[model samples]
Target chain A: MRVFENWDTSLKIPSMFLLMMSMALIRDQYLISLLPCVAAILFIASGLPLSLLLSRFRAPIVFLLFVSVFLVLFSEGDALVRIGPVVLKSQGAILALNTCVRVLSVITVGIVMIYTTPLSGLSGKLKRMLIPHILVDIGIMTGRYIMVIGEDYNKMKTARKLRGYMPGKSMARRFGVIVPTAATLLIKGFQQSERVFNAMRMRGYGSSAAGEARSYALERPSISSFLMFLATVTVSVLLIVLEVTVETA
Target chain B: MHIPDGMLPGEICAAGYAGTAALTWLCIKKARSSTEDPARIVSRASVMAAAFFVVSWVHIPLPPVSVHPVLAGLMGILLGWISFPAILVGLFFQAAMFGHGGFTTLGVNALSMGGAALLAWAVYRLLNRKSGERAILISGFVAGFAGVSLAVIFTGSVLILTIPAHIDAGTEISAILAMAAAHLPLALAEGVFTALVARFLLRVKPDMLL
Candidate 1:
């Protein structure tokens, strides 16, 4: 856990990205299945609670199962199993398995990357990676205010509930209630933005290069971080090579 | 409609990133060249993006189920060209905060959703030449409907076309159609919601509409 947390964002971001892309590129079922095992190992190494990962896994797992069921039911191949009037094809089953493995592996890697890294470091890393400064600044502000806006919505909902506002059964009535609430939120948000812009101007934001200079300063990657990044890139290249070899065989 | 990571091929994801980078650069350039102060634009767009993100949490009951409004069209009508960057920011926060989407698929998701917003904005601007309340509501409804429908089409096409499987072409088409059919109700709901909100804003705070 400390190893990943201590790793420099410069290397960590690209390493995780390569790992995910490798998982996506692997076509052979047996080779693809190895990734989830690797992800499990990484998950355990992260030292986060098993429940946290499980909770995050719940929605995607359900979605994967739904997709897999569709593939098994609709795909064409020699019939592998008979259930009443339905036929499950061997090809469909393989496709379903491959899809599940690939999706799960990629999702697991994403979860590990997100959970292990501090988000505060993300904007900086993105900037350093040459992402647009405006996009990064907007991203930072948006991240900072999602909770604030969400809390405001909650308060408004509570106020409405206290004032005997009931969401009726009809869709029109529901829209009636929702539209006003949404309009008010937008209005407040617009007004708040003006205030925020004024405050930023007062602080000399955008008056000079200082605003750009205030971006998060990233630390240089350590030797160990570089080695890990190299290992990740090598593994990714090997996975692609093996996938191509299996395909050509 | 957020495409999860691993659902797409690495090459497709890479292409998505490439396309998104170009579009984002264009948007930033447009924003910087605008008459409005760049900082003010960013501040307003960011805060409004946050507001829209919260608004999406409002669930509309459709009997046995409920759906959240994407509000991409409303965002387009309000934020203009800044809608794309605001949406990109909003998606990033959603992916990071709740894992609702994947980091690798960010570009694809942004393009689908943000592209819809741009289309909506164009439609609204074209139809909104008339200076009447009726035109505003009608254009708003059309924009909203078009936005979500286009997003659904883009997402369905991407997912159905890109599934690394042996499913026949017939099955793929049917799957795409099925996905579109499933989201039709949500699209209609968003259309009505956007129209009503546009009308409300015009009455209370007209400038906020654009």
Candidate 2:
């Protein structure tokens, strides 16, 4: 898919940076939340397709359903429906609705951020943030190699399937074989890494980057955007505090 | 176990964030002493990262919930303190990329998930070195299951601890119970999956074991 192509390199950094900052801005209440939700809506409205974006959130949506349905249907509140042992309450529904909205809002904001920033930028940003370079580098390599190993696994699976290797009553036997195969892949990956490391050493890999990589300047924040973000967070937090206080009173 | 944003009470989240940061600082300090060589450091970090990356994505469906093996313990056995950074990195990316978790909760996830790895490392050191195979596998199982269960319990207990005093007793109990119930299958599945993956790793690269 076009969206997936060079996706990590395209829009991961700025989006992630924003996400991190925005998270800090979110308060315990609706004021901070409403901003992100509204921002997500506006972001969706501007050019991004909501359906396509929502499609990215299918997993979270399913999880929300399973986790929240019981909570929403059982607790006491304004009665919506009651069938013998089952009781659906308005309060419960509202609780479920709020959770779903929060989940969607987070997912939407993440999707937009990822779609616009590059993966390299995310790591670069982390390094800039004074996060340990070793951690950042390890994360980058892991993401890169997981895809590598995954592709290797998929290819092996296809080859095995071609040879009449089907999972069935002989599942244990197949599993036994899969272990050795996966090990071989692990060894192969290690060997490859060794060679790559050697090559890098010969080329003086760490010598230059060691010094140059210490710091990178952060992006300049726009005054208007910063203020808007602050306003959203403040208002959302207040609303949530007010709601909880009123409910208790 | 990733705790997404807004999933729990604000107080619980705040407390978790604080607790997580303290533990993470301790882990990082512990890791600092062992970073004598660039090669060793890089390999340990890479392997831990690779293990976590592999485990995070390859989930199996178990009826109501889904689970992937928690290689945290395995990572610890193989990579020691380096697993800390690897985990920190993994949790950060998961939050930034997936929004399956929040930025504020990153430290908490790393501590809960990575803490198991450190614990596994400590436990492995206790068992006979000859039973390294069995030790690693068992450590993996214990850490995997414990990681999932403890994280949930910790998260749940935190909620209980931080509930606003004004919240009714019923609302408090139900929320706590709901959180606990939701995590039941995940713990079992994580334990089983961890055992299998550990077995696979042992067979493939016995050298991976400490």
Off by over 4 Å in 2: A1-37, A73-80, A120-122, A169-210, A213-215, A218-249, B9-25, B55-67, B93-99, B102-104, B128-140, B155-193, B196-204
Task: Judge the docking of candidate 1 as incorrect, acceptable, medium or high.
Answer: medium
* Per-candidate local distance difference test: 0.83, 0.57
lDDT of 2 by residue, B1-210 (tens): 466554555445456557765665666566657654454455556654654565456544565344554556556665677666777777766665555565545656667677767776676556425554676566666655665666666656553444222335676677677776877677666655555556666776666655
In model 1 chain B, the worst 10-residue window by lDDT is: B93-102
Prediction-by-prediction clash tally? 0, 13
Chain A alone, TM-score per model: 0.90, 0.69
Candidate 2: count the clashes.
13
